[model samples]
Target chain A: MTDLAARQAELVRALLADGPVPAGFDPDRVRAEAAALLAKRRGVAARLRPDLAATLGDRFRPLFDTWARENPRRAGESFRADLDAFARWLQERERQERERRSGHRLD
Target chain B: MGLPTLGVGIGWRSEIDLTVERLPGVDFVEVLAENVSPDPLPESLRVLRGRGVPVVAHAVSLSLGGAEPVDPRRVAHLAAVAEAVDAPLVSEHVAFTGAGGLDSGHLLPLPRTREALDVLVRNVRAAQQDLPVPLALENIAALLEWPDGELSEGRFLAELVERTDCWLLVDVANLHANATNLGTEPGRFLDELPLERLAYVHVAGGVRHGDLYHDTHAHAVPPEVLEVLGELCSRVSPPGVLLERDDAYPPDAELAAELAAIRAVVSR
Candidate 1:
């Protein structure tokens, strides 16, 4: 890649993924910017899949933030994959909670 | 300069189809280019077109500033939508959405360096070559500034317009966000821009999140943003002003009132 292209890619990684804040960049500001991007994505997911958003209720933004921290957005997918992954993550958490509740009752 | 005085309009979305259809004062509607298929245009858009209300194709995913060349398929889709709508012109952002093969899912600002400007100019010219209608570029609201930027946003945009001979899509809400967050004066930013190149203006709503202003488009148009619109009109009345409400739509009456308010500002 050209130097400019390489620098641009590094900046995108820093924003979307957990890549390091590039040299000579303000770390705090970039972190804030990354958080803002994730928040915007969360809003889109909430709009596209209101059912999943409602199911997660208050924990929606936080959970999506956690997921987005690790997963970069796939081009042309339009967050369908992210929403599906979020739904499954919620289901697993619910299942774990159910098992814990049943174990407590048995005790 | 070829665009007519389209008056006040709204961004058409599926959620607010009935509202947009019934809005009386709307002169035109802008459809998200990515959302419509020319083979089967949405009924809402067809109704507007049938009524002789102009529909402008506005694209969000072109990623015109990305390091990669502008995707021909996306440009072709935009061309098809413009033809389908018979639009006077189409609009896309001056920002890049993705790099390194990952979609940012939102418009990200380009570094205001000469090299970045060259990349944007190249991509924009490519898209312009394919598009059936003229293309206007909108400046986006960004929270972060690249440390490597050498020129101001206005100078960078003016140079791009001069180089490409393209039109401008000035989003007033975005100006407000940048002015508030980046410590730039809105009027000064407007002055730096080539106002005569304006095809239309975008007026949306946003909220102040802590120290930053977020141009959410889901909130009500605040007075400060309206004031900036008023200032722009005082300088040069654009051919059109569009109200963009992507979500959290209010009642029909509320939406109408917002359109009326925009008309009042532009006509003043």
Candidate 2:
């Protein structure tokens, strides 16, 4: 890749993923910018998957933020994929919580 | 060529189709190019076209600033939509949406360096070759800037316009957000633009999140953004002005009131 292309890609990775901020950029500001981008993504996802949004209720934004940190959005992928992945994550968390509660009750 | 005077309009989103269709004063509607299907245009959009209201194909995924050459398939889709709608023009952002196989999910800023400018100009020229109508580029609201920027946003955009001879889709709310977040003067930025190339203006709402002003079209048009729109009208009466509300849609009366507000400013 050309220097410009490589630099651009690095900057994007840093913004979308938790990659290091490219040299000479302010880390705090970039973090703020990334947070803003994720917030916008949550809004779009909410519109696209209103069912998941309603089921998650007020937990949507925070839960989406957690899911987004681990899964950088792929190019040309639909919001349905993200919605499905988030739904699975929520289910898994609930199952684990239920297992722990059952264990405590048996004890 | 400049666009004809399209008095006042709103972006046509499927969520607010009924409100947009019922609204009385809207002169035109902009549909996202990606959402449209040429083989079978949506019924609501067909109704608007039937009513003699101009429908503009506005694209969000054209990533014109990406290092790669413009995608031929995306360009083809935009052309098909424009032809299907009989649109006079299409619009996309001056920013990149994704790169390196990862989608940013939002428009991201490009470094104002000469290399980035070269990439943008080449991509735009390539996209223009296939587009049935002229492509107007809108400046985005970026929260961060690159350390290697060699030019101001206005100068870079002016140069891009001069080189490509593309029309400008000036977004007043975006200008306000940049001015508020980046410490640039919105009026001064407008002054630096090539006014003759202005094809239309976009007025939207934004809210201040802490110190940063988010140009969230989902909110109400703040008074400061309206002032920026008023200032733009005073400087140059653009051929068209549009209000874009993506989510958190208010009532039909609220939407009508916003359109009336823009009309009042433009007619002044």
- Candidate 2 chain A weakest lDDT stretch, 10 residues: A75-84
DockQ of 2: 0.66
**Candidate 2 docking: what grade?**
medium
RMSD of 1: 2.2
lDDT of 2 by residue, B173-214 (tens): 999988987787887889899999998999999889788898
Candidate 1 error regions (>4 Å)? A88-107
Per-residue lDDT of B104 in model 1 = 85
lDDT per residue for candidate 1 within A1-107, as digits (tens), equals 87667877888899999898889677876887888888888888888899978877898878878877777787766577768877787789789999999999999
Ten consecutive residues with minimal summed lDDT in candidate 2 chain B? B1-10
lDDT of 1 by residue, B153-222 (tens): 8888899999999999999999999998777678778888999999999999988978889888888999
Q: Model 1's DockQ?
A: 0.65
